[model samples]
Target: MSATGTYNKLVPEPTPHSAPYWEGLNRRKLLLQKCRGCGRIRHYPQPMCPSCHSMEVEWVEASGRGVIHSWTITHHAFHPGVREDLPYTLATVDLEEGVRMLAQLRGVPDDKLRIGLPVRVEFETVKDGLTLPYLVPGEPA
Candidate 1:
């Protein structure tokens, strides 16, 4: 937390299956796992396709758009890392690509937070050369 509600450091490790996804983030490009077998895009970058359990997974570029599926305004810090970022937002965005992502929302006041609000993805570089995606509501996402 650099006096900004950007991101906090987690134990950093990128496995082989998830490396490409991280690489795309380094390039400021959003990527998700697209199952080659069933042709469905998914998140969390699993080793096997969720729907079909096939090992054929490919990286697909996201439109970088989504809507607020759900969210919560936090006031407590379970860890020292998030104490400074109190009253921040943690939201689940339902992406247009059919995958959902959990992230913090920025540039919007807390009172304006609502369900099903349109949001668009933007990456913020926190630390360790890691740029994490964030969302802000506007214009149908």
Candidate 2:
């Protein structure tokens, strides 16, 4: 705890540009930006697609299915908010849309964190002010 009473938690806030993405999260669904021009998918929702540099972008619903590209086992929790979640696995998953995302892994052992592990989306309230979409180990390869 800080003297200022700030928890320094991992809370996510939705901005005017990204509110829809967070809104979709509340519904337990995934949303990504797709280029209306080139049909390319984007992860960090931008005003334009990175490929064709076109401003014609639209929000497309995703399957929320992906595979673990990489992961890290957090043995120590430096922040007070994350202390309760110690030893949790943080994973970077590659979605079928070709976009990579970082999410917390659940329902799996930390020793099992491996590359190319199949994963699925799992939504939960990660903090007081936010409900985030996490990832859980999917079917075995």
What is the C-alpha local distance difference test score of each model? Answer: 0.82, 0.79
- Relative to the true structure, candidate 1 reaches a TM of 0.87
Clashes of 1: 0
Q: What are the models' TM-scores? A: 0.87, 0.85
List the candidate 1 regions with Cα displacement exceeding 4 Å. 1-8
Global local distance difference test of model 1: 0.82
For model 2, residues 1-141, the per-residue Cα lDDT tens digits are: 232445467666677768878877877678898888999988887786778889876888887778888888888987778897787888999888889999888888876777788898878754444568888878754
Q: What is the lDDT of residue 121 in candidate 2?
A: 87
Q: Tens-digit lDDT track for model 1 on 75-123?
A: 9887777787787899998888988998889877877878788888888
Estimate the lDDT of model 2.
0.79
Best by lDDT: 1
RMSD (CA, Å), each prediction: 2.8, 4.1
- Where is model 2 more than 4 Å wrong at Cα? 1-8, 126-129
